[model samples]
Target: MAPIDLNLLTALDALLAERSVTGAARRMGLSVSAMSRTLTRLRTATGDPLLVQAGRSLVPTPYAETLAERVHAVAQEARAVLGPASQAIDPLSLERTFTIRANEGFVALFAPAIITAIQQAAPHVRLRFAPKPDKAATPLRDGMIDLEIGTAGASAPEMRTQLLFRDRFVGVARRDHPLFAGPVTAERYAACAHVAASRRGAWTGPVDEGLHALGLRRRVIAIVPGFLDALAIARQSDLIALVPRSCCHRGGVATEGLQSFDLPVPTPELAICVMWHPRLDADPAHRWLRQKLMALCRMPA
Candidate 1:
């Protein structure tokens, strides 16, 4: 038996990623003919067709799709192993920006603490908070986001994560609202006009689920995209808003005109987390950032 050709692995990963031989060739700066030969070599070496033509396009075989990510990861790891050791990070001397993608509520709740902590240790470092309109990791994979803070969703298995905090839902309205003056029941809570926070614009959520379980439903008069928007409308109107207790206590939301009460039904508690690409798992600066965040998160309630 012959030893595996390590160079071919890079070619294989690239080919699988692009599917098309010509596209992969352009990516690797090889001519179409050269890429075709490499693809032939790959098929012989792996004993898989890897990619098959479909009309004018090429598509990866199921096996090839499965290997694509792993192959890319393996090649990156090998490169890191052969490369020079990562240099020690100088917090004070470092001058770089880290972009964080998060929902509006999370940013309002945690950004100040994170920014202050980073500034205290690394004065030259800058932080950019970007809006996360949906649960997608494309920004992280593309190197646009240095970190993400939210409830863990369908993330790539290779991504790394750490729990930040646990938050439960709370019903909020104006401070002097009639609901605040009496024992709030499920029926009473459901009777009020509600402001729903539906990122996808759907007027339903865990609150609705809990209400459904109790054979009750709230009268949602308006649907907003984020917690901040919901809270804003609730503060000025008679509408009730279901908000995360932790978020409600954040600087922006924890203001006059807001009064929060426990939801009458048991709702799921969201486990907030910080996520990053596995490639940055061992980076000194990234490690430092994660540490600061973890420490802040662990502070007494």
Candidate 2:
């Protein structure tokens, strides 16, 4: 058999993705005739009509559909392999900005350490923290955000994820609050007025469900958009703030003027993960930043 040209893989990937000769031509910067000729070569090479016309638009054959994801991954991997050499990326000399999407509580708890570490190791590099209004994958796909720190619920299947750490909800209140007068119980906890934190403005979650199971319900007097805000409200007032354990504690040190306690009812543990698009898998600097974050989160506090 004659040796196959590696360039054909690039053309085949574009053709399969676009499903149109004209589109493939535009994507690969080739003329329509050239793309059509390339498609002919692809047919002979694969021994299958990768795409077939069904109506106005072209549709992939069963075989072509199976090849789409694999081919796309291969093409992306090749590009990364051919990109700037990994040896050239020295953190101390590198100058680039990476944006991370996360909630204010995580920012308050972890950002200081992360920034300090990065500054000492890579003074020329910069970090940008973006507010995470939702776990939508568009920002990562579009390169608007480099990393996202949060749970992986409903995450895109193709995106890559790494477990950073686990957390649980803990109730907090002002120091010397009335609730501390005796042993805390489910009934007394539910009787207290609460201030809930939810980015979507929801006032109920696992805690409410747990309370319901025991024929109890807490009074939510107000709702805020973030845990940080909820903590502030709890600190100055009598309302209880249920937030992640990490947010109000660092190195076993609780936030001043606030007393933390585990909820009386059982709740699920939160598995926090750092997610990113697969396209950044082979980028050395991105990999470095990811490792740094994972290490920091794993440290005893």
Candidate 3:
């Protein structure tokens, strides 16, 4: 079967409303001859003389009058479809799972705030937090994860990102560690055994580089996969754990049991960001999630 030409509906609707060939042509940015030919096609399609001359003016036939309102409605809907898109996300009515892939430290740090905020706004929405084992973009590109939060490394150049906050590494250990007895100088900080957080376990990291600047190095007795594990070891033993101050949490407080002391030597500050594929940049639900995450992150720390 031959497909129906949608443009013909617009011409019929306009010609019926205006009741003048010249007027319909002007409204459609076409000449009178072009509109007359369109009217001929419309007549053949509908098998009716949709518009007839009434002296110097044009009048709509009974069939044209019957289809006027419906055609106009269809034309309006088509125009909207061709125009700019809309954001009609209804959070309260939405029910879907949003997968977020992030490092263990980030999930431990930011998940509570994000969960609370999302739950309060959208009761039915579910959050799936996936652990990021490495820096790769395949999950995002393939839609396995709705969002990825962490430092935007060289992984996903095509992803869109919004900076959430800046974080710096801090030395943390048991409350009664001897480093608290005096100033945490490079020598004192380097003398203690440390727990290094390296998923790949190569040994050297930001803290080591900072110590290198002072011609000092700490003994990394053990290498762990994540900061939380290192913190757990440091909490029980005398091992020193270097972790991001932003991710350390205590009950009802931003910085608690963790003793955050400025690094004796310089270390690069890392920016925390929320990243997602550019394809979802304008998606209403994705936009809501991004906005909620950004707002929740801005809360006083």
Candidate 4:
């Protein structure tokens, strides 16, 4: 079959509404001869005498009457689809669910405030927090996850990232532990047993490398997948848990009976960011969510 001309729908709608070649030409800002040609094309396309002359007036045929309303509706919808998104959105009126992929540490630190802010502004908006086991852009590119919060290491270069905050690692242990009685030094920190938090269960991290620079090493007695687990073990036993300072104080995760101290050896501060695919770059709702998260992170702790 031959391809149909979408432009003809607009002309047809004008022709049917005006019911006269001169009137349609005036309405569409075209000459009468041009409007006549358009009518001929519409007639050939529809295989019908859409307009018939009745004395000095033009009247629509049964076929034209049946198509008039449908063509007008379709034309209106097409215009809306092609037009710019200039209408303002009301958050309270918006109903949507956004999925965020992040680790437990981020959830524990920021989920409560984020959820509360979202609820207060957009009560109908729901958030789904998914587990991020590793830094992979597949979910973002494939549209499975709306946003990702974490370090951008190994992330796809095409993904857009905005730094949420800067966080430093801190040593956490149960209060009144022998390490807290006196000032913590490089050697004292290295001599203590530690719980390593690594998604891959690695026994070493930046802390170990820092200690190695001083010709010292900390014994990692256990390897855990997340910071919470490391803190859980550290709270019960004598093992020291190294976690982000924000995670320890925010959301009361490690603040109960655990004490956080600055690392004796310096490790680079981790940059936490929110990442998303370029597909959502211009989306209004997605932009709003990102703004909310960034503002929440920037709030005073």
lDDT of each: 0.85, 0.88, 0.85, 0.89
Cα lDDT for residue 112, candidate 1:
82
For TM-score, the strongest prediction is: 4
Name the best candidate (by lDDT).
4
Give per-model TM-scores: 0.70, 0.71, 0.81, 0.90
Q: Which stretches of candidate 1 lie over 4 Å from their true place?
A: 1-87, 252-254
Measured with C-alpha atoms, the lDDT of residue 261 in candidate 3 is: 75
Per-residue CA lDDT of model 4 for 212-260, tens digit only, reads 9999999998999999888888889999999998877683746678999
Worst 10-residue stretch by lDDT in candidate 1?
247-256
Cα displacement (angstroms), candidate 3, residue 31, comes to 8.1
TM-score result, candidate 4: 0.90
Considering lDDT, which of the candidate structures 2 and 4 is the better prediction for this target? 4
RMSD of each: 15.9, 14.4, 3.9, 2.3
- lDDT (10s digit) by residue, model 2, range 87-203: 447889888999999988888888889999999999998999999888788999999999999986646888899999999999999889999998789999999999999888887
Report the lDDT tens digits of candidate 3 across residue range 122-214.
999999999888878999999999998888574578889899888888888888888889999999999999999988996877978878867
lDDT of 1 by residue, 72-132 (tens): 9998887788788686888999888888888888777777888898899999999999988
Off by over 4 Å in 4: 55-57, 85-87
